[model samples]
Target: MPIRARGARHRTGPLRSPGFLRSLVFAAVAALAAVLPAPVGAQAAARPTESRPIYSYESAVREAVWVDTGLDADGDGRGDRVAVDIVRPREPAQQGRKVPVIMDASPYYSCCGRGNESQLKTYDAKGDVVQMPLFYDNYFVPRGYAFVGVDLAGTNRSDGCVDVGGRSDVLSAKAVIDWLNGRARAYTSRTGTERATAGWTNGRTGMIGKSWDGTIANGVAATGVEGLKTIVPISSISSWYDYYFAKGAPLYDGGPAELADAVESPDAQAHCAAARQKLVDGSPRSGDWTQLWNDRDYVLRADHVKASVFVVHGMQDLNVRTKNFGQWWDALAANGVERKIWLSQTGHVDPFDYRRDAWVPVLHQWFDHYLLGYDNGIERRPMADIERHPDQWSTDRVWPPSGTSAATVHPVNGPVPGVGALSASPAPAGTASTFTDNPALDESSWAANIDKSTPDKAGFATAPLTKDLRVSGSSRVSVTVTPTTSSAHLSAVLVDVGPDTIRNYAGEGEGILTGTDRTCWGVSTAGDSSCYLTTSADKADVGFTVFSRGWADLGNYASDRKGVPLTPGKAYTITLDLAATDHVVPAGHRLALIVAGTDNGLIDPPPSRPTLTLDLARSGARVPFVGGAGAFARATSGARPNVAAGVPDGTPSSPGIPVPRMAAQRLPGGAGR
Candidate 1:
């Protein structure tokens, strides 16, 4: 249901898919009937005018357009042009009032009338269409803002070759924006010329979407197009290599089996296979490829973007790593751009789902503040609002806000509820917990696998809160461990466990109601046998500046044979840093910290073996608290303010990286990559 651009052909008759075409056909018919002048008197006068539906809010209004155009790629006379469709919203303020336009761009053939009709009829029990917002005509049109859904230049109905991450996509977006501005001025409405003029003249256009759409937003923003306002990239990775192929390792060899199945559709599989081959065929170390990837990369130099921004991401998102969000956040901070971020316990697919009513208001507030110029209680809210549990919304002035306290809770020696502390000393060497990594024997090893009961993990907790404790910002943990081999994967989760219910305010229906309960957070990897814990320096205080190898190696650690042994009788710290979040731990709720060598149930298990050792006395965790006098606690000892290690601290680079050259791919109609 992702949006695509409008193309020429009309299939005629009833649509086989649940799409705007069927509705558009009806409207067109009605228009034809009304203007025929054959039926006189009452019948003719009673016919309703073919008008776009309007959704009115306190500050804005919107009208949807269902358009179809021909893809005349070579200016040829033959009927070779493919059919395309698009759904655009006419925003009153954007015309001349100078409102910002928000768009969702993807190559998924979103508007290509395919199986849409059948899909539309299948609604959830709540009567809302399932995944309907992804449909062009359904969501974007009624939002009271200008929304453009394009078919990537050479996919589906769009002409040209499918360049993947090439220049055509970005250029097409720019062209669409220009077209919208002109169309807005030309299309006069009953509201008068002033409204039409204001819609385009006074408007600032921005982009917002997830996955593919998210990537496009970044690309368009990078173009430095005038009036390009801001972007809200959800669950998107800036670097293709870093995100999909390598996160310090090769492609997740055994990760996300579901993705494999999802891509198995003949068409999708073909596209993905080609794309993967392109990745391999194109040299990884090539400056050309690197430059091309970097130019298309959203995170490489986020500072290049001058737009005010807001980012929202989930901690447990297996599809896209949470660290990518950190990269963007840090980039904005480094550029000294005003921004806001929201972190949640949901996954990549949840944010756009309507089951989360909270998002509706939040999005409205954001657009109101930026596009409509209506303060309307938006600025009064926290710069960042995160969800620790479903019922609690924690607010903060900035991300990873200051004022936090750290306390170590031992694993084996830590007292269990109703049980006193068992030991005050560290365990002997090799005296640690272990789990086997037999992917063949494990069904739960798939990516994002969740085990709510008897989780294969250990936890430490603080006593029930004496007062309402709001914990906002990133959370980090340091742990000591020994792997069975040269390399191992480790994952951690921070949960607010108690009698209070923790709702996932993002997912849909049964998925939302019964999805994983833990508000899973950030993750880091270690590549070698070293005492060091891994975390992205990009999230550190000064923002994202590339560090030389002399500073920090931006890769995971690898261990030696016999694995890195945990020093017996010595306590080592394992830091679990959570992404910046907003949540209030109500009085009487305990802040639970769960540490595991793997999050196999919720995500793909690491390709390496892992063993863990916990230090009882010297190891501790940290949590940030804000609000009220004496309501917060300060770090007691052994707690050092987390700094992004290995990066040149506080030094900003100039001009950033240059755009790389890309090799063109050929298309069906002799189009080049």
Candidate 2:
């Protein structure tokens, strides 16, 4: 057996015997040959009979590795080791050809898994990922790239307590990139007694994922790590504060402790109770920004990001909300990060499920151009992909499509919640509109009664448009209000008060549910399932759809961190903004603004209803008009729109798109986009 040639293999021995490792070295040489271009005019049979390849997708090396984050969250004294399971080409491992990495570091690996199909990792006898969740590993690993699945510290097999988005959560994966570039240390085992290294890597890497996984990508990229080249964060949060609160309104009933418990190790809660308690105490239920939230906010330090970014978010995503994407998009743009974007109408769904056929190839090209140094020309392509309808995608040169313009409109009060009109000019001086806060009613339900007298809310709008009016981007609201009570919370909504069949977003279930609906996305193994229930939305008649919304606590209006209660009957000026939008108010539809109390359905209900009076003469809403030529100027100037009763659609129209982009359509300072 010792007299063997370079390519010879021992017929009988341990799988990784000395003969096998040496033969693998030869196989690595053959893998290197796989990437080299063929020589010119040489006889095919006479080519160096290459034994090792430069790269081979199907025959790559697959194994598990541990990265030491250099932190001990549980105080056992050992470095909190992060588990980085890898699928790489063997040739790259043998020093044949170095490969860049595609990483999806997540806490979901052990708890729930990833993607719509919810695929989790499976292990062989040695504990390698036999079934990597979703399609990223299977599709990209075979294309001369290494796919790394990391178990965030404190979850799965990683050693540490889940610190949420704190140092442990963020720095754990940063250590992996550091190790790839030789800046940090890794070990062969969780015990840290043995050594391990990433000698096969090129030190360049890209991170991509959705929700918490994508949030990790954003958090890591914000650290300004040198080896991180790019990131693709889909439906992700740039600020954890935005996830749970708006202005001074808590979006959820429970505090961050519940969230920590939801994503962390079930048994490890006792160890991380202090960290979890910090979240509870910091999020004071009254909805104000705290140091804990600031630490978790990636947007604040986005200026430090050197990674090119790609963002994908759904407009109807109440879970993460479009604001997460909006604020982060603005910051990334302001910081001049190289970027691309995709805006969808789905609710908390991934693009792979919504745009299956086009997403994979586009993603493949994106990686090839950024990570592999390929001249794939993806940079020259359109920067935005927007959904005009479900599955009806259109590519645009820039988002907000160029030529968007903003116009200010004043509210003319009427008797009820949805009855008033929006005037081109300011309301009469000294005129004021009053309404009481009602915690029991939802926004759409409150808007449903245009004719009913309501003491709880006031609505104002413009007459039906003669032609389609496209409203894009966030709208700013400037108002001065006098409250009857010491404290009050204000909510504003921009409604398309037209007779059209809009999406059913009034309830918790934002999408249509299809019965007996079942479909498979990717290949499945014993350890993972790939099929999911098909969903469909059932459209209903509505007076109008609440396209954009905003919230503000009168007490917290002056400062997000500090609250100043109002003196009864003393008016205070507060300027807030509604959520961003890409909606089209059809011809003969009115653009209405509804000023109410807390959004009871989504946020915590206020203690009591406060009768509030708004100074209508000084209050108005600013809208981004992107309809066509002169639409913005006219809407702001002298356009006389007809205020007419809308006709119910004879047939159900496409679910009124609940959401949408950037460039030639960009407004001032990338607004509207």
Candidate 3:
């Protein structure tokens, strides 16, 4: 259930550290260059010419391949290379012509002799071609722009090691940009004017993609690279530790194993299998939490990024959590950089569906505004544009802005507001909920089926909304939990349950489900229930938690049979922080808080059924709200009038918890109109 792209095949054997590929590229480039001939007057006649090769397009869609040459700074042998794919009007703009460039730096072998044809043939679940096809070029390319897919070093035919997250990746990206600009200059010289410019040569470049590619786009932007006008980093993490490891705990258990099992190639499978074994063997070199933090530069400090950004996350993404999006958003806001975010209800792969309709166009518009300098109304857009339950899009100037208040929803036995506080006492002694970790259940059972028959799951609901409420930011629940054993995992989910039916808004179709909108809005449409919305499963979200390891360590507290006896009558508080989102709770709808001993389908079921105790007094739930009294009054009445409006526009009210300045607000009388 975690958002994961289908794995690519490994060519030969287990992937040694990328250090070996670096050596290979260096050797191959040198050997090839040595045998090639030097052209006469090659140095004196250093002029740019349009090196046209094959080109094709149907209707407005266009696809072309051209070769660019430059000095190889790394001395790996091959000339600095640039292969660009252009799709747009053949004629230059009547005025100042500048086309935006959406650069996709592919780790798959996109260059070399394999070409685009070979890449598209690969298939994932659903039998549809898994890889992005060149025929798929029309989506963004034809919209008066160009899409450049760069084959990262050593992958296609490019030289150097395919460093995952090292210096090479950054330098190689810069090198590509330089080559592209040079190509534009050459074309201009040949045409006797700066008429035909390709890629980001004459304009700006915006990075966009999902999974590994998406992560790389962010990595490059973090370098503070110039010309990176803006970026749409979808379903990616800025920090590896927060992503691959959980609170310094290795993520090698259920989720990781399921991902490993999906790889079809013997080589790729062997590598993951080996890594898994090493983890099981407790090998020192297996790269644990400390090792990963030391080995990879995952943290994306606010001061490091120079480009404006639009981050997308999914609420139900079992792989990467909305928390990662919050981390990046907070860092940028703290740095005072222009930023926007979109939280979708779908999972990692669901966003890629052309049928979904909203996100793809938004991505194109983002690039159009930044790369092509088009006044496509992107700048006027809000900092966060999210779609809440049912279906709708809402915009806001800032994210979880100041003035939001935290309102606690506690379970009580008495009447409405005056019901008086439920006894500030723990559950009766010896009372607990127990469930077993059935091995027969598929790993994805938690997120796949939504019949409400799952035994290990528990649900709590809030009274119908008294007023229009926007629950944004992270949602937390404090429960007194004691695992039957010293070492056990606890999982929780915050769901928006309907009055009559249970809806699975976070589920998605086959393939990688990128949780972009769900991460920001936290709610999903009725039919789109394939994605799972929770932050406990993803490392990115946990990294954003306000509390440190001390707050998250439940410690095998539930290791006994009486189901981790709750301190007899004492109340212990366990926090279940749901994924972040901006959603509006209509006056009629109720919000459900779901807590489960296991992450059902997303992660491996618990080793055994553990008993957990609910201490409602010390344990309570807090949601982000925008309007109320005192401090939040201004935000609600002055800016967020929607809180008083009856209609829902997808944007959820802030939980009102003061989490710095990233809270939501509305203009008087609804400025959006």
Candidate closest to the true structure, highest lDDT: 2
Would you estimate the TM-scores of all the predictions?
A: 0.55, 0.84, 0.57
334-366 per-residue lDDT for model 2 (tens digits): 998989888876666677666655676677777
Candidate 2, 297: how far from true, in Å?
1.5
| lDDT scores in order | 0.40, 0.70, 0.42
Which runs of model 3 end up more than 4 angstroms from their true locations? 1-100, 108-144, 153-175, 178-200, 241-288, 291-299, 349-364, 389-391, 401-403, 411-459, 500-553, 556-576, 605-609, 614-617, 628-673
TM-score winner among the candidates?
2
Candidate order, TM-score descending? 2, 3, 1
- For residues 1-673, write the lDDT of model 3, one tens digit per residue: 1111111112111223565456445433432333344477662233211111111112222333323334342344544443333444343233234455667665543321111112322323432222333322334432345556655543443444444444554556655455455422222221132333343336467776555456667777777766778877776666544444333222333322232233212323432344444323432212233332433343444577777888876654445555566666767778877777876644453343421445544555566556644455666767776655323456677788556666665543222211112121333444334333343432223322222335554333343444565666766656665445443445554443222211132322311223443221111112111122212111111100111011122432332101232333343455544556666545544444444443433333333455554444445566666652332222223221122332222222221111111012211001100
Per-residue lDDT tens digits for candidate 1, residues 1-673, read 1012221112211123545556556544553443345554666453533232232221223232211122222233321111122223334434322334666555553322211111211223532222323333342233334444455544443443344444555655555555455532221321123322333434466677665556667667656666666777766666554443332322233322222222222433433444434444553421123444554576655656766677777654444556557656767678787677777655454453312335544665566456545435555557776655543456666666665443333444232221112121333444344333432322112111211212344443344455666655444555565444444444545544343333321222211332222210111112101011111101111111110000000113221101233333343333433444445655554444555553322223444544444443434345445642235332111222112431111212221111111122111101000
Model 1: residues >4 Å from true position, as ranges?
1-100, 111-145, 160-203, 238-276, 281-297, 314-318, 341-345, 349-352, 355-365, 372-381, 387-412, 415-458, 463-469, 504-555, 558-580, 603-673
Worst 10 residues of 1 by lDDT: 545-554
lDDT for position 666 in model 1: 12
Worst 10 residues of 3 by lDDT: 664-673
Candidate 2 deviant stretches above 4 angstroms: 1-59, 91-95, 414-418, 501-509, 512-543, 627-630, 633-673
